[model samples]
Target: MDLRVLEYFLMAAEEGSITHASELLHVSQPTVSRQLIELEKELGKTLFTRTHKNVSLTQEGLLFRETAREILALYQKAMRENTGAETLAGDIYLGMGETGSVVFLMEQIAVFRERHPGVHFHLISENADRICEDIEKGLLDVGFIMRKANPLTFEILEMGLRETWGLLVPEGHPLENATSVTGKQLRREKLILPENSFFQSELLRYLGAGAQERVGATYNLIYNAFPLAKASRELIVCLGYPGERQGGLIFIPFANGKDAYASLIWKKRPVQNPALAAFLEHIGHTVSE
Candidate 1:
C-alpha cells in the first residue's frame, strides 16, 4: 500500500473525523476521504465506522493502526540512522511506572546528557504491562518494570534499589497508625491493588491463597484509585518511598518481606541508535558500579 495513504488513514483514525484530519493535514476533506477509501479497498477490509459527523475504527482498523504506527516509526528511525550525524542525535523513549528509583534513573540520564546534549529523552508514565507492550512494538527504547525480566526476551540491568511495598491508607483507618503491616493484617482489609496479572500474582504469592477474593477494586493506574480509597476505608497496596507523602493519605510498609524491584529492560536485539547505545552503556556501567 501507499505510505501517503497510510499517513492519511492514521491521521483520520487519530482525529476521529475526516474533516479534522483534513484541517491538520492542510488538505481538502474530500482528498482525505478518497485516500481512506482507497486504503480500505486495497486492504480488503472496512477500517472505519462512518457516522454523520465523526468516525471510529473498526476491530480490523484498530489492529491495522498498530501496524501502521510501527511502520511509520521504523521509517523515521531508518531516516535518522541514514543521516549519519557525528553527534548523538535521536529520540530515546522510556516507559516508567510509579517507583522511587526514577530519581536514580534521572541522575544517570543527566550524566549522559552532559556529554551528548543532542540526545532527547521521552518518558512515558504507564503501567508495567503497557510498558512491555510499547517496548515490544518498538515504540519505546527502555522500560522500568517492577517484575523480573524475561531472560529470553529482554536484556536486564537491575537498578540496585528495591521498592518497599506498602499500604496507602486514608486517615482514621484501622491500619493508618501502624508502622508496618503483615500479610494477615492486609488480608483482613478490603484491598485496592494494581490491575496487572504479574502484580496480582505476586500479591497473591505474598498474601497466600484465597486472598484474591478480598480484592475490592483493581486499577491500571495507582493514583486513579485514590477516589475509591477516599470514599471507603479500603487499603491500597503500593510502594513506599522516603519523604514521599500524598495529601490525605499515609503509607505504611509491608512487614512480610515482599518488596518490588525495578530493572532497566530492553529487547535483545542489535542496537539501533547511538543515543540508545550510549544509554545502555551507561546503565551497564551504573549497575556494575
Candidate 2:
C-alpha cells in the first residue's frame, strides 16, 4: 500500500532473494522478508514462492513487478528533477502548437541529451488553446502557441523571431508562382482555416475586410488543412508555418505577415524543474539562432 513497501517488494523481485535484496537495500535479511510478506498481505496475493534453494515470481508477482518498475521509474525521475539533478538529468512535459518548429525542437533536444544524458522529455503536440490550458493546469510546464494569444494566465518567454506562415497547396496550383497574394486571391480558392481564436478571427477579418469576402475553406487546425486540400489538387490551404520550400504543396507567404506571430508560454513563476529550465534554455537558444 505504501510506496516504501512497493519499493521493497520490487527490489526483492528484481534481486530474486531476500538475502540479495537486503544486501542491495542495505537492510537486514529478516527486514526484507518481513516487508515482502507485508506487501503480499496488503495486495492480497502471493508475490513470490520461496524455498530453501531458490525464489520465483508467481503470476501476480510478474504483473506487480512491471507496475512497480513503472512507479519507481516515475518516482526516480520526479525526485531527480525536483532535487536539481535536472541540470544534468530530468523529465519535461512540453506541449507545442504543431509547426515546423518541432523539427527545430527535435534538433535541440538531440544536442541537449548528448551533452547531458540525465534529462528526458515527454512531449505533446496540440493547437495553441489546449497548450495554454494544460500549462495552467500543470499538465504541461511549458508550451508554444500563436504569439498573439491572451497570456493573462501564463508568461511569455520569447516572442516574434519565428518563421513565416505560408500557404499549403497542391501541385500545379495557380497561386504557386506568387510570392504573396492578397485577401482577394485567397477567398477565391478553398482555404484551410483554424478554429475561432483571435488568430483565425483576426486573419478572417483582415482577409474579408481587405477583399470584402470569405478567404478560403475553414477548418479547426493547420493539420486539418492537409486532409481537405489533399482531395483536390485545385484546393489550396492557407496556413501558418515555416512552410515547405517546395513540394506537393506551395508555401505562399502571407502578405501582411500576420501568421508569423507565435510565442512560448508557461506558468508565470520560475520553473522548479531543472530539466525544464535547461530545455527552455536550449529552445530559447534555438529560437535566437
Each candidate structure's count of clashing pairs: 0, 7
Task: Name the candidate that leads on TM-score.
Answer: 1
lDDT of candidates 1 onward, in order: 0.81, 0.67
Q: Could you estimate the TM-score for every candidate?
A: 0.71, 0.62
- Tell me the deviation in Å of residue 226 in model 1: 2.1
Runs in model 2 deviating more than 4 A are: 1-87, 149-151, 209-224, 233-247, 284-289
What lDDT would candidate 2 get against the real structure? 0.67
Clashing pairs in 1: none
How would you encode candidate 2's per-residue C-alpha lDDT over 70-113 as one tens digit per residue? 46656766787688664365556778766665565677779989
Give the total clashing residue pairs for model 1: 0
Q: Show model 1 residue runs off by greater than 4 Å.
A: 1-85, 242-244
Per-residue lDDT of candidate 1, residues 181-259 (tens digit): 8887765788888877888888778876668888999887777888899998888888876325666778888786567
For candidate 2, the per-residue lDDT at 151 reads 62
Candidate 1 at residue 53, lDDT? 99
